[model samples]
Target: MTDGIESLLPPAVAIILALITRRVLVPLSIGILVGAATLASQESSGPLSVLTGTASRFIQTIDQSVRDWDHLHVLAFTLLLGAMVGVLESSGSMARMISGWTRRVSTRRGGQSLIGFTGLLIFFDDYANTLLVGGTMRTTADRYGISRAKLAYLVDSTAAPVAGLTLVSTWVATELSYLQEGLADAGIEATNMTFSVFLQSLPYRFYPLLALWFVFVIATSGRDFGPMWAEENAAAQKPRSHHKQSPAGSWADIFAAVMPVGICLIVISGVLVTTGLQEPAESEMSRWQYFGHVIGSGNSYLALVAGGGAGLIAAGTLAIALSGVSWELVIMGSAKGMLQMLPAMAVLWLAWALSSLTGEDQLNTGGYLASILNERLPVEWLPTCVFLLAAFIAFATGTSWGTMAILTPLAVALSINLQQSLLASETLLAASDMGLSGGSPSGTAASLAMSPICLATFSSVLAGAIFGDHCSPLSDTTVLSSRACDCNHVLHVRTQMPYALVVGVTCILFGTLPASWGVSPWISLLISAAVLWVIVRMLGKHPQSAST
Candidate 1:
């Protein structure tokens, strides 16, 4: 009944089935059913009841997800955003906007670079970044011979890494929440102190930083290898007939697209700061800390829902007033857009359901992985080990947030234990006694000092989880990126994996491993960048060259 091999079966089944079938929904459903059966078998139930129990489990998962306010808000945001995209497409605003931009983006490299830049600007949330970038750029990318698989890659690579690294983002709040719990259990209970630790750990976050740089490298250099190279070459050989004549759109078309996005940003930011200040402050703080705390404590999900609704309305109103589209057409466009999202939304729902089953209350998949760190190890090896472990768990579970929830506390506790053991060595004690005028500091003092290994381990968990998320087909961001580009999900995964694996391997060798041994993360980062540049230049080829 305890967390064990059973916890691994469901995700394993889901991933394998998804790959073998090249489809998501049925595989995800079967995996959930397997998970439910696993849970039910633990109870003393009859065969008939067990079958019925599996159905009950499926229904309950959806019921719980829908009833939760945050989940409901996410669903609302997705639907509204989908409707907005529909309106833009139906009214011809989207096409016209892309046509205007195409003159500036005269080459494939420029188009890819623009997409990457837009992704960086929308750092408030990953979902928003993925959806907005893909929808806005898909046509231009095609005109420039950029493959759908490549477009999906550009959108996905930027979405999570940018959001995760930014100071004020939906990911920051989640990261801070888990870090607070981890620090509290590790005997650093100050609520304000977690923000400081979070900031301190930023420099050591090598994977996200390195992953981002790799995106621009591929964009600017026009160099690619692996499955992506073949995709790009194939796309380049196609007819250049995608947007032969730019639509007769004016400034109104551009405004119809840009205004809604601008409004969405304003509304999300305003609501975040407003809701963050709702409760009275209990302590005085500096302006910087106050701002950081506000962002970390804000109701981001609510902000997202409000922004989505406002954006949808703005797009629809513009389409009707300026685009000369009939109201009926606008309604139909909205309906069509929302309907398109239904399949992706269903996959998202099933993904969330599977994630829930791996929680502490069910199969305890994360718990089982967390238990592995309890074994003692040399303090220097902690970061590398934690990085590998976090990567594996996130790949298996398909959720970075869940991996953080499971590993943060356990990794922090383990780091402290290993540090304590190292400090208690007879040689270390004698050296401390001889070097200092007084005896060693108290245990509390030693434990409170954040060591290099602690910082590396903290960063490792974050970066490794993202690395896994990039490669996992079950990841919601991956699914959204593919859907937004209208790319085949299986093709997206196949093409993206080689790039992710390259960066991931490089991250471990130059980043996590070196930092664990007290090397400067800046140096490690520089080395990693240099190495990647060499790899891309030496091995990569231009799609144009390949096709020629």
Candidate 2:
């Protein structure tokens, strides 16, 4: 359906029902059916025709999604990672690591902070961060009586923002390309200024920076609010007798945990490097640029799959070698972990199916949004509005890359027009005031504000995409965060929503709005932080039973 409002329905329905039902699968399935039905109704108005169209379209969607190599690749990667986690758990690697950590970091706050900080430190790749940090830290969190949902939150909260901020991340290349394209489209000659521009945007990256601060504040303050508080409180009161390991299992070898993860990283790096390896032409200048090009263009999904497979093999071998676990048991545990992923996989499939409905061949949701907003959107307000739009689109489609790819050019073009319009308006005003019919210094000043405004919107698009992906149930990182932390997917979504929203709202209101209105980014950060503090203080309370 090319209908703009209709395009929003499926994801909106799914999100609402998910919140109300506290379950993702049924809602997602219904959403998929509804979307297909919508598509069918577009073909013919009859209810019977719609039913027929939905069945055919739904089957086609599922089959096409499953058969797509990219989809299969991601599915394989996710399931293998789950198997890897299962192997780690059975080998007592997690238990031993957690037991020692528990002894040293005795308090729940310390434990939570450790997990949060670890996620921040593992910033090179979000997938690596989510699976490695969340997977390993879950037991430690449980030992300290932290809720699984809270652990998932900490894991997810740090993954995207940290990865987005880091220079050498998988995200960097993609982000740079989009920005370069936008700048070029805006007639800004940014030749070889990629790194410089990114560095400048660093200060303006209020959402991610503030999000990191939000996590730290919660951890250090030992306070929580919103739905998260209730869960944290209940988790604290629950006895951890089941989490405690016997003295025998305490001797589980560190190598059992370390080796598999090491191999995973090595394999992923090796694959990306090997596959993306290419010689630069004699015309090329910098090695750094060439290497960046290599990394930026690499197939991250393939690399992840390579890592997952290697990890599965290494983990199984290690468990058999060090933990004295039987090969059969290791295999069985791995199988069980793969099976545990079935529910998330089902949800993921439906999410993917829903996304396809708005693609090039289907209804063009992004283009529709652009068309509708083009007439109504003002130039000065472009940054804030663009940020909000990117967030909603990313949340709805559950695809940050898709959202950015669609919106970056549009945002950049809009910003340029807005700036030009402002310059023209200022010139007219200056001429009218001085009784002179020519351009003035005010126009030049307004023209200068153009690039900054564009940059701010670029930052917003990036920030909003990350935030939307952060809280989306259809997001792979969100799903993996729950899988890694062993929390219910919907429950994790519920508990984590408030924290994400606070950072997001603050970034939009205090950061984007003021930054566009001649306000400095540093001031925006201060205001955003102040807002977060006020909200958290007024609403967030220390969960009563949290372990000291």
Candidate 3:
């Protein structure tokens, strides 16, 4: 499985089935079962034993994943967040918040921007961003004739990209850790260079940067293409329904909803900083390095749990005190919210199990893909190639973090060695002297600068991971976005793909490719944006106009 193309089977089965059937659970289950069977078949067992092995393998993966404290922490966070939402809804806080938002965001553009900006503001965790944005903004989007698919797109687009790109977020730690580990594994001293390289690589992360810009383009321009336009147009023609007043509505309804979210954000940020500072620091580490180190070492999942609990408590207290609701009502609200999350939790659990099956320990799907890039090629093409490879792996595995973990070390080592090998060759050295080194500095200065190939490939992994996560139906963030927006999972995937592809291709063409050839990333980004603007104006349609 590790060495063969058969490693790609499980995810292929799952993704193909999901597309054909337009369903999630059945396809995911079948894919997992198939993967389990493949693993089981490798053992010397009788038919009966092999059958039992398949079942036992499935059970073990789920059990092991659930037993992990990190997984439990995430689940707990989701549960608590759900409880907070329930309290808000049951207490009429949701309706009040919606009403307030509706008045301020009179048009579809404002409503969409509000959702996008809120997502950007919550740049700490993708899970929190997706859940908070999708759940809170769905109703307001509905009022503005925005479809569930559109809401899901906005939420999904902003969630991972923001978390991945932001200076301080749950993703920052994992990303830095992976990059550091990759550098260390490549025999590079990472003490000072890891954070520095990461900072340099940020500009090369064209997908996330473009994706964020594309979101606002979609938001402010009020134009859409493909299935999203159809969804939006249909939604526009449908009469807007008035929200029902809660029997327990009060003057503090808006306060009740907004306060809990604010408290959650504040508590999470406070915990992140505090916990980060608590980690062991090196005297030699600079202020920025120490900051990155602190964040990279902090217990982010714990912070999520603490923040969720605090928000839940605030919501319950607000329901009881401000809304003057009964303790029973508060309890029910909490229970109700938690219950609503059960389906998504189940999806997450299955996703984790499936991810485990495809992980380095199991099928080694990522490893197989990594092995294919062993052949040498032009240095400038590495970023584009790496981006595509990372995208495919993430799409198959449905986890951006997993894809990064698998590819980062390999990409770093490969790029460094390739560059060294090329520099050693007389023919290549002559070309490098002739300015074929992609605008790299000459002589000793070139040695001091970060390798353009390394930086671009590094950023490509992050960018591609996000790209695949956005389009993949099996992705947890995608699932969370669908769940939060209350959109059909398959529908969300289907509608969002066109918009994702448009930005994805544009960035690859105008951002990564040119930038790799020594074009400044800022210039590439500007060209990409201008191209995207042309695309939207030429290809996109107004929902209201299209409906008429």
What TM-score fits each model? Answer: 0.64, 0.61, 0.63
Residue 182 lDDT (model 3): 52
Candidates sorted on TM-score, descending: 1, 3, 2
Better of 2 and 3 by lDDT: 3
Predicted candidate 1 versus true structure: per-residue lDDT over 193-230, tens digit per residue: 55556766887888889989999999989988999999
| Cα RMSD to the true fold for all candidates | 7.3, 8.7, 7.9
Backbone clash pairs for candidate 3 read none
Highest lDDT model number? 3
The segments of candidate 2 whose C-alpha lies over 4 angstroms from its true place after superposition are: 1-103, 242-378, 428-450
Model 3: lowest-lDDT 10 consecutive positions: 440-449
In model 3, the runs with Cα more than 4 Å from the true position are: 1-100, 244-375, 426-449, 545-548
Better structure of 1 and 3 per lDDT: 3
The CA lDDT at 305 in model 3 is: 80
- Count clashing pairs, candidate 3: 0
Worst 10 residues of 1 by lDDT: 440-449
Backbone-clash count (model 2): 0
lDDT of each: 0.75, 0.72, 0.75
User: Clashing pairs in model 1?
Assistant: none
